[model samples]
Target: MTSKKLQVIATDKAPAAIGPYSQAIKVGDLLFTSGQIPLDASGQLVEGGIEEQTHQVFRNLQAVLEEAGVTLNNVVKATVFMKDMNQFAIVNGIYSSYFGDHKPARSAVEVARLPKDVLVEIELIASTVVE
Candidate 1:
C-alpha cells in the first residue's frame, strides 16, 4: 500500500479558519478547500447582500487556491452553500465573473444556516498539476 503526502494550504490574505481546520489541503494532484464564508482576513464577516458576500467568498477561495499553487481555472469541482436559493442567480453571476470562461462541475444547495450565519459559503477542489 502507498500513501500520498498531504500538505495544509493557508494564507493571510484569506480569513483564518474559525475552528480547528486548515483552509485547504493538498494531496497528490488535488487541493481540497474548506468552505469559505464572507469573512475578511481579519475574520470579520463582510457586510452586504448575497452579491457582495459571494464575491468575498471567492476572494477567500482565491487566497487559499493560490496558497495551494492553483487557481479558479484549476478547479474541477465546486460546492456552494446558500442561505437562500432565490439568490442563486445573483451568486451565479458573480461566480461566472470570477471563473470567466472556465466552467467547473458545480453543486449548489440552500442550507438551513451557515457558519457566522452568512448568506453564502463556497468551497472548491482544484488540480495542482496546472498545464
Candidate 2:
C-alpha cells in the first residue's frame, strides 16, 4: 500500500493553526481542513454573538478552500463543533447562507470547550477539483 502525501495548505484569510497542525491538508484531489474557529484573516477572533461567530468560521473555511483551489461545492462533508447546543438554530441559519446551493453531509456536536475559547468551530472535507 502506498501512503498518500500530506499536502499542507495555508492562507491569510484564516487564523493560523496554534499547534502542530496545518490549516488544511490535501491528499490527491481531496482536501481536509482543520476546525476553523471564529477568527478573521488576520488571526483575530470575530466579535458578536454565535451568528457572527459562525459566519466568521465559514469565511475561514472559504479561505482555506480557495487556497486549495476548490470551493464549498467541492466539500463532501463537514463537522461542526459548538460550545453550546442552544446556538444550534442560529448557527444553522448562518451556515445555510454560506452553502446556498449544495448540501453536504454534516454532523454537529456540542463540546465542553474549544480552542481559544471560541463559541463555534467548523471543519470541512473538500476536493481540489469539483466533480
lDDT value for candidate 2?
0.90
The all-Cα superposition gives candidate 2 an RMSD in Å to the true structure of 1.3
Across residues 28-131, which tens digit of lDDT does each residue of candidate 1 receive?
99999999999999999888899889989999999899887788999999999999999999999999999999999999999999988999999899999989
lDDT of 2 by residue, 11-93 (tens): 98788888999999999878999999988878787888898888889888998999889999999999999999998999988
lDDT of 1 at 55: 88
Poorest stretch of ten by lDDT in candidate 2: 38-47
The candidate scoring highest on lDDT is 1
State the TM-score for model 1. 0.97
- Count of steric clashes across candidates, in order: 0, 1
TM-score of each: 0.97, 0.93
**Per-model lDDT:** 0.93, 0.90
